[model samples]
Target: AVESEAEKRDRATREIGKRVMEGWRILDKKCDDCEVPMLTQGKDDDKGECVLCGKGQKKVLTEEERDRAVSEIGRRMLDGWKLEDEDCCEVCDLRMCSKGDKKECVACGPVLPPVNVNLELPPNFDFSDPKALEALLLQVQKKTSTANQVPPTPALSEQKEVDKVNISAPNTPNRYGSNSNNYPNTPSSMQMQYPNTPSAVPVTNEEMSMIGAEQKIREGWTMMSRAYCDCGGPMMRAPNSREAMCVNVHCVNSCY
Candidate 1:
C-alpha cells in the first residue's frame, strides 16, 4: 500500500527526529578544535587541530592539570547544556569531577576504539522501514588506524589560484552577504509566482494565474470568491466573529 500524504508527513517527521539524534550523537564525541567527530579515534582529550578549518582549538591539560577541565565541564553543565555520562572522559571512565580507578585507563591507553557509525540518507527514501535505518547506522570501528594516509597535494597552479582568490577577494558576497562588493542588484520588477496558486487551479479550473506577469494587467483575469483585505494582504483571523482582519501588523487598517 502507498503511504498517504498525512502518513508520509508523520513518517518524515519521525525520520527527521532520527537523523537529528544521529547528528546529536555525532557531536557527543566531537573534538573542540577540529570540530571533527573523532568517530574511531583511539584516545580522547581534545587532541590535535586539522590546522586548516580548525577553530577554537582548546588547550589540552595534562592528567595532573585536569582540575580546570573538570571546572569547565561543570560550568557547561550548569549553563543548561546537558553533559551526559558518555560526555565524561571515555579513557578515564570517570565523571568530570570524579577521581576514581581509571577503568578504561587513560594512563595505560584506550582499550576500545571510538564507535564510528555513518549513514547515507538520500533525498527521498522509504522512511517507513525502521530496521533499514538501524542497519544503515550500524557501523563498527576498524582496529587499524588510517591516519598515516597523507592529504592529497594540489597542483602548484591550483594552490596559487586558491591563495589568490583567498587573498584578493576574501570578502566575496557569498561569504559575507550583501555587505560585499560582489552582491548583484535586486531587480525592481519581478512576477510573484506562488506554488499553491497552480495547486488550487486544477483540471476544468476557471481560474488562471497571473504568475510571471511582466506588465500591469487591466482585465481578462477572473477573481476567485476568496476575499483578501484592502491592505493588499490576505484576510486572517479576527478578534470578533463580525470582523475581518489583515494579518499584517503594520497595516493602517488592520481590523474591519
Candidate 2:
C-alpha cells in the first residue's frame, strides 16, 4: 500500500519533532492543529517553530514565553542542521539552515556561505602613493582590455620585439632599490616580492589615523558607512570611531 499525502506530512513532522527534542527548547504555545507545543532555537530565541506542523511564530517570543529557552545551538549544529539564519523564512519564523542554495526550515535543510567577500589588496601595496596607484590601475586596465581581444598572429619580427621589451622591462629598478626581475609579471606577485620597499613619501597625521583600519577590514570588521575620499578611494567608517577615513596610502586627506 502507498502512503497518503497526509501520512507523508505527518511522518515529516514527526521527524522534525524528534530532531528538535534532542536540543531545541519546547514552548508552552500549542499548535492549534496538532495540539503539540512549539519549539525554538537561536541566541535571542528568535526562532520559535512548531515541532509537529513546522510553522513559525510571527511575533517576538515573550520573556515568560522564552523562559524555557536553552543553550543547545552547539549540540543541534553537531546533529547536522548547520548554518542557521534567524527569521529568514517568510512562511514561518523558523530559522533557516543548510549548506547552500536550498535554505528551508531547520528540518527542510540548506545553507550558504556569508555573502561578503573581503576586498583584497596586493602585498606591500602603497594606496597613498599617486604614482604607484596609477601604475597598478593602468596595469589592471591593460590586462582587462586585452583579456577578450584576440590579436592577429604576430609576425616573427614583431613577436621578437614584444619578447625583448618584456624581458628588458624586468631588469629596470623600480623606485625601490631592487630590480623588478626578482618578481613575477603579475601585480600581486610583484608586490609580494618587495616586502621591504620603503614608502617614497613621509606619512602625515591624516595617514597615521588610517593605520589600524585596513587590518580591521582584513580581519572582517563590518563596514559602518562609506564615502568617496578626496583621491577617489572609498573612505569607510573607522571601527569604534565616529569619523570616516580613507584607506588610500597616497591621499593626505585620509580622514574628516
TM-scores for candidates 1 onward, in order: 0.17, 0.21
lDDT per residue as tens, model 1, 181-215:
32222121112212233423331111111110100
Local accuracy of candidate 2 as per-residue lDDT tens digits, 174-230: 334355344343233322122232446322322222232333343343333334555
Please give the TM-score that candidate 2 achieves against the real structure: 0.21
Model 1 residue pairs with clashes: none
For TM-score, the strongest prediction is 2
Model 2 lDDT at residue 163: 15
**Candidate 2 stretches greater than 4 Å from native:** 1-17, 30-36, 41-45, 52-256
RMSD of each: 25.4, 27.5
Clashes per candidate (backbone, < 3 Å): 0, 11
Candidate 2 lDDT (Cα, 0 to 1): 0.39
Model 1 scores worst on lDDT over the 10 consecutive residues at: 207-216
